[model samples]
Target chain A: MTVHAPSLRQEWQIGPFRKGDIIAGLLGFLVLIGLAAGVGRLFAGMGATTSLTDAYPWGIWIGFDFALIAFSGVGFTIAAVVHILHLHQFQPLLRPSILAGLFGYVAVLMLLLLDLGRPDRFYNFLLFYNMHSPLFEICWCVLLYTTVLVLEVSPDLLANLPWKWPLRLVYRLMTPVTIIGITLSTLHQSTLGTLYLNMPHRLHPLWYTPILPVLFYISSILAGLSLGIIAYKIAMAVRGQKENPAIAIGLGKGIVAVALLYLLIRVGEVIYAGELPLLLTWTPLNRLWLGEILFCSLIPIVLWATPSLRRQPWVHWVAPLSALLGVGMNRFNATLAAQSAPTSAFYSPSLLEWFSTLGIVAAGMLLWYLAVRFVMGSAVKLGYEQH
Target chain B: MTTTQSELSRRDLIKGMGCGVAALMLSSAMVAHPELAHASDGEESDSAWGILIDLTRCTGCQSCALACKETNDRPNPNQTPIGLDTDAYSFVEEKQIENSVGQTESVYVKHQCMNCLHPACVSACTVGALRKTPEGPVVYDADKCIGCRYCQYACPFGVPAYEWENPLGLIHKCQMCADRLAEGESPACVAACPNGALRFGNRKQLLAQAHAQITSNPGRYVDKVYGEYEVGGTSVLYLSPVPFSFLGFPELGDEPNPRYAEAVMKQTPAIALTVASVVTALHLFMQRRQQVNGEATVHITSQKPGDEL
Candidate 1:
């Protein structure tokens, strides 16, 4: 195979002051502010830094950590689609989605560090063993899967190196690494829901069910496939190339099936649990539950399933974004709203939490774009085109 | 020659990892199951220590709370703590209840850790930082705790309180004076109770005494003991004139809180093996189909650089 050396300096050019630079600049600024906020939180402690109390030990940090992990399912989900299922027509989207997954997990790790009361003991989960704990399993899976992700994305980096052997070795190992990643992801993504199973007393009945693990796992795939469409479109745009419309349409079909199945089980469990009456109550919590179903399941299913609506260019963007938002809301609602605190005290996040959360998100976007513009630009396409 | 050898090695690697992951998960599941199943047993041992609190006794006296602070060496021994916190491991909750004649009356209920026989916090803790000891106290090891606070959600009684004021905080709860028990003294709260409101004894004897008190004192005490069967029996028992729910005790079932979590957790190995097997099977099937369709296997390094999609 003859390798074409990329024209490196041209891709790195930022002096023309384009729109991408401005977004990058803004994200960079937010990241700086977020770093400062994180430092303040670590120094002053949770009591002074955030509105979190004993009544609300977990807040937006956990909410996003859970959501991001779901979103990051793009890594394994897409890997499964292309490598495992041998659907190579979707190959161009793979690298970008995996990169997004890596970034999402990194942001989750950062937020988790901030959320910990003892951030210094972040590695304590590794030292301790508690197989009975859902969190313990999640901790181990996240650590292992992150390593798998680093290896998955390393090919792009290795291709740029003077030595060719590293890339060759990784290429040979891709099939096993991908399978391992999917297996590990299956454990933790489902286990995130299992984390909530312990809190049956605290969680609202409408959202709490014995099948929470199943619900969480399915929604992750829904979110992952939706994000894949977005990632593919964005990656094409970043590369200054036109996207194949067939890819998004194909993925949209997959989303509808998963969304319908998810809706069935999610609502079916509530009925099975005899909590359907709770859904009709229209209490604030009930309304939130209905909203989750509407956005997460109803709207995505309708938007993607209808042929006329699916063909519209705008639906392409709106459908997937709607699914992503619904999944995000579900995670946040599960983490915060569904919980019934022992005390009557309500939680409102502090500015520090808001800033730091935004900053971490900004940092993730910035790194993603930088990689998209520089590191991932031609190498991934070249690798796929050759295959 | 090189391509064939590398392909064979990669397949071998896949098979090896699949088995290794399954084994790891299975071994962890095996190690974890027995301990979890044993922990879920709610029946109290004959030798286990227990606390029996009689709420009908004449006192809203905060002496027990003060003694608790002193014994625990918490900061504010003099201050009356209305709720449990890092500085106050135990507190007396004052409630206004209507008597039989419909007139309001004051009742004080002392609150502390229930030390459940099947403690959800111990099972939910990421680090196994909280443990149910054979001596009947669920002790917390601060050194092992990373302060993830999953325990706070797991405790039905809302017992574990975080030291939110500290930058590096740890969970604080009543350890039922394990040190005092070791020294052959009763818990400080029981020792300091001016009235015999708090009784310390072996669980079996205390349970019998509680039943006897209810039977002997015809209409004086509520027939039900609050902790006798709540969340599979708590070490701390309570007797009151009113239903325990009116005094803000959580209504719980006989099934323990961690039952679902631990049960699901024990299936981790099985889940892993099943997933790995299915995915590997699918991969192999896909590869076989592609070969049968007369398509070449796609490898990153095997093709020319400029091929069309």
Candidate 2:
């Protein structure tokens, strides 16, 4: 009997392109542009169009963009742990995980530009350096990290492109670039949480601690790992591939471990900061605190720890989705709900701000779809079955 | 073959157990040194700077706010439409608190940058746009600002205000009149305070004065000195007759914000580099091993596979 080796190349070929993808992306882009223009008009009139007041200087732009991006630090945290840490089993989820991070950060940068009073002067960040500002450190690290991500992910693009010296150089340099990327991501991700240290008076005592930067880093990693698992499941389903049971189970266990650690640290923070009394108070803010701890952390732990649930396909889906929602809730509470309390008068977001936030998310998803179609066709090809 | 499979499974079990143990140890270590876990390697500034607000003497007159507007050249808040307005740098808020005698007494709290020894806003500003001056004021520079508004979010005091109304918005806050300090004068608000409500001096001296006031008259003031050790001590200090919370002051712990970031920053480089190096080495090893085994190889084939040599 003659045995023929299965064709790996056949399964991994670039899929056919779809014009509909580009049209949808273009439409989303146009909508985002329209929303941005509307915001521009409002700013041109000196923010008279918005409901923001002196009592609440920060609105949705800061809450969603800054706070949300900080939460999304999970992306880099997971990428670093799985890719750089040599966790070979996690290789299946790395591409999509990093892609999500890329999109999240890009969304942050876009929102930042829109939020700037003088978006034109944004380049001045490069020209001037305030050594005293934590913001200065954050800006440089984020910019450098973004470049590093592009370089690290470029291999995917280079693999498809006609081979050239430049491509070879990039492939050769990928290791160092990835190392630098990890370093930069770590610095800026934690720095985002550290930014709140100065406003101990502004943040609620229950949420505010000296260890927030550490907490932020830990939570981000937990969230990132969970998000990666969720993203992989979705991507695999969309491309019609059988899920890797081993990877799903491995990540499920990882989530439980991280969630337990996060819960312990959160409880420790409340105790160390002498905020246990605040937790007993029956205010709306206290309820948010409870929700963040119970829904975002505790329930996910309970769901993932069960042996039967860990093995189920739906568990992988539900676990990560829950973790993502939990992280989002924690970030929102920390940024808006926890900070703005005792008076609802100071915390309501303006209509334009809300529209702009929704537009950014919509536009990000649209771009992601196009990028996946064009730049990341291989990601889909990875799961093709052998006959 | 069955024996080999069992041996392989055993090895896998051992490896998994090792990972579990390592994770357990890491978590324990992290819990023990929670504050030190994320410490970044940055030079801690030599001189800790701050401010002192004497609430007992404040008259609730808006003179300091007026002086701040004039000094900063901010727009008039009253004339400018609600959302369009951006004038006051240091404003006073009135709060009615019931004392031990159960009488409602109105208290005025002056709000401004606490100028934390380890300022979160400074850490939050990725571009180094907002900084803590060595002389003890948290200041903002427009040139380095990408208008991220991270400073606004990171500030526990909620002092950093964005000029959202401006097409080219910049962050606005009281620099404690840094320019005036450079010229050897007190902050505009401090100099303008009619009743000695705001005092400008070296942080050490101000702190001593605050301690003396609280110690000398126990019942006259709260036992606490507001910014003395909060958030690793602030440049600004506050003294009040009522509880700080009742007067709108946040109850902050002693740990500074930078300590948190610093701890994580310290561990990240080590972990990241180690992981990257190991992964790179593994990848290289696999590639070399495959080449030697003659199982998988990179071939630069010309044309399609069927047409190639």
Query: What DockQ class does candidate 2 belong to?
Result: incorrect
Task: Indicate the DockQ of the complex predicted as candidate 1.
Answer: 0.57
- Write one digit per residue (lDDT tens) for candidate 2, span B205-271: 8888889989988788998888878877888889999888787677767877556544554454344
DockQ values for all predictions? 0.57, 0.20
Q: What is the C-alpha lDDT of each candidate?
A: 0.85, 0.64
C-alpha lDDT of residue A337 in model 2: 69
TM-score versus the correct structure, for each prediction: 0.95, 0.71
After TM-score superposition, what is the CA distance of residue A116 in candidate 1 from its true location, in Å? 0.7
lDDT of 1 at B210: 96
Model 2 Cα displacement at B170 (Å)?
2.3
Each candidate: how many clashes? Answer: 0, 43
Which regions of candidate 2 are displaced past 4 Å? A1-46, A49-55, A66-94, A130-135, A237-247, A267-290, A293-313, A341-344, A378-387, B1-68, B76-85, B91-124, B130-139, B153-158, B178-309
